[model samples]
Target chain A: MAYSNEVRDSFSKELDGIREAGLFKEERWIKSPQAADIEVEFPAGAEGKKVINFCANNYLGLSNHPDVVEAARIGLGTRGYGLSSVRFICGTQDIHGHLEHRLTEFLGTEDTLLFPSCMDANAGVFEAILGDQDIMIADRLVHASIVDGMRLCKAMRDTYKHSNMEHLEEKLQDHQDKRIRLIITDGVFSMDGDLAKLDEIVALAEKYDAMVFVDDSHASGFIGKTGRGTHEHCGVLSQIDIITTTLGKALGGASGGCVSGRKELVELCRQRARPYLFSNTVAPVIVSGAIKVLDLVSATTERRDKLEWNTKFWRDGLVKMGLDIKAGDSPIVPVMLYNAKLAQDMARDLYEEGIYVVGFFFPVVAKGQARIRTQLSAAHDQHHLEKGLEAFAKVADKYGILGKSKKEIKEMYGL
Target chain B: MEEYKKAILEYVIKEYLEDDEDEEITYDTELISGGIVDSFSMVSLKRFLENKYDIQIPDADASPEAFDSVDKIAALVVRFKQA
Candidate 1:
């Protein structure tokens, strides 16, 4: 049956409004594997070209690594492709249990439970645990998944100012009469790459008798001394109550996530969380790939060191070139370009110059906070960084965003 | 009453109008529908009003329609202050 004309017109009109406001999201096609340099097929049927990828979540560059590929191949041979049912219903395999145990050890948690994605882990945890007598206070800048999770819970919900401990304190005190309080935050805010002050949050949690939860999706497998994530980085690994992170980012860039924390909480999620209880078990290949990534990252800090070096190199180069880059240590660096149209144009120009990056604007961020978010990878060597820098310099020069004379740019970039 | 409006306007300007300093924020400036105020800003506004007026705003009343414009928020403040 077809929808009525009124409904069709309303939907089409809203879409038109989105397009007019430049908020429409367009997906770019990548024809090759996830890597530092990739073959990108243009939207207009243009010839595909190898471009330096600065937008992928392939932080440790294990997405297409030889060892990771071989592990997946072996997994296919030994563990099979998938289990068509949920974990409790004949989906649990030896590899699944092994991966869960490996994650628990790696994250330094008492136990762990896997989900289809960190998104599911986040969405399912709140409703399963919290009730009307509880209060959930979250950072306003947390990922949308957290917001949806909070909405599903039967708790008194409040959002503090982004990274504002004072506001968080106010909300915590406001709802102190509640039976339980849960503080939710993203370990590293994705758009700006700013780290949450976990030490302060832990202190507040202790004072208020609240549990702290950190979604370390963007920080896992590459942050801290041994790549254990924000809790480790903040020196509060033992204090954090719950941690939800993805294997899709630095951990091989495949598809799986887990909730790792206190043993009882993890067991509760395994039994009660809707996503884990209802969704199909994670594929054997991704589980094998994730285990391999953990082993590789744990054995040596070489890849993370390279990623740190590349991030500093690229971020410092952009700064030296007079770009308004946000100050942070994370590999996710955002170069501010205020205007939405300008950000979109810059991304297009960067792509034409053989550098792949994406523009973020409101409502992905606050209004007037448009930027080009460039994610660095360990696979990016010195030459790759130089080439990407050259492309960025050229694009900025063309658009006058470099804010420097031609001679100055050449001297600074040695172009 | 004017004092309440002034405080809210000042807060909005100090926070959201960093880039658009020249743009004026009047009483009927459409804070919610126009997207000048978002979820984060709305909560801040709610807290500011609650603290300043010494009133409690129930969760059901903490909505966009209840405080879409400065006039509506001003009315809400008056209603609660009287109650």
Candidate 2:
């Protein structure tokens, strides 16, 4: 059953616009677990044929790690499967406590608490500490989950332009008397893969009498020395007031999120965060597995170092190819193709050549900044990075992007 | 007012353009919709307006309207400064 025919048709019209705009996303059925090279197939009913996988959040190559897989199995054997209850009500397990403590220690924070996803880690935060009297000034480019969380609170919400500490201070200038003035930003912006200038933000926070909040989902498992997050990368881990991160990326390539910060904030989220109180507990196997993942991260920097090397190789190669890649040093390499159609065409071509990456255009990034976002991981070898770079260069040259780069296009457009 | 006007225009062009080539682009040329400025530079422009010029912009003003062209951005800057 569906809505009335008129209403149904009305929604379809907008969806058709999405298709026309080339933003209509369709998922391909994956025939294998996520990895550097994925195999995906369309069912018999669909129009497209089988394709290799390229887009996944698994940055550490651990989604299918034998050791991680074994840990999941062992946890299941010892702890059983799902917990039907939420954390407050019969959902908390001994492993949950252990994992939280490990994350806290690893992050060099006072405490930590888990969420079903990084999205909820953000969703739970604003309402937990912010109230009608509080004020939050966020970076304009923070993730959607943070926006949703802000909506749930009554605090006065403001946005500073991405990474602009001066603008953040200007926004904070008027709120000098609020009960709380907090600055929130994504530690590493997910789309462009640029890092938030935490040192500057911390200075602004101190000058303006505000607390700091950062979501380290994209940066947590790979950027810093010990893979701690932007805090470590910024070398200001102790100055920030709050840090939220994900286990879904470089950690274990499974789903879980957490907030690590002052013991009070962690305790506050545990008791007052709606999702934590209402959502079902994460599967026991996932928690236990994540505990082991944290331990592995604590033990070595091999994977993290590989990730940095791989990122430099890819970023530098794309630049040498005369492509317009964003300048941020983070692992996210956006090969800019301003035209949406060109971005899509490039992505389609890359898929055909067995390279997996996604094209991001308007609404995700600003219009006319359309790009192919290439995420590099420890899982990628030198050969993999070189192959991806070579494939990108070939496709870019074929599209007239090599000799006539995004720079030339900007020159013509006066932008 | 005159210096603010010049600096704002220069900043907009510098943020929009890759190589700081010309200074005569019209004030009303579209920045976002005309594809002169994308998300990254739009952000840079916002910071320029806020910090260098002391103008306050709401999140909603991030659209093409305020940043559409030199004139529109100048107008936005003036209105924000006056306010």
lDDT per model vs. reference: 0.86, 0.79
Report residue A264 deviation for candidate 2 (angstroms): 1.3
Error of 2 at A99 (Å): 0.7
At residue A332, candidate 2 shows an lDDT of 78
Best by lDDT: 1
Given candidate 2, what's the lDDT at residue A391? Answer: 83
Model 2 segments more than 4 A misplaced? A42-54, A410-415, B1-83
Cα displacement (angstroms), candidate 2, residue B27, comes to 9.8
Q: Write the per-residue lDDT of candidate 2 for residues A264-310, one digit (tens) a residue.
A: 98889988999888898888899978988877778888888887887
iRMSD of all candidate structures = 4.1, 7.3
Q: Over 4 Å off in model 1, which ranges? A: A4-9, A403-415, B10-26, B34-37, B40-61, B80-83
Give each model a TM-score.
Answer: 0.91, 0.83
Clash list (residue pairs), candidate 1: none
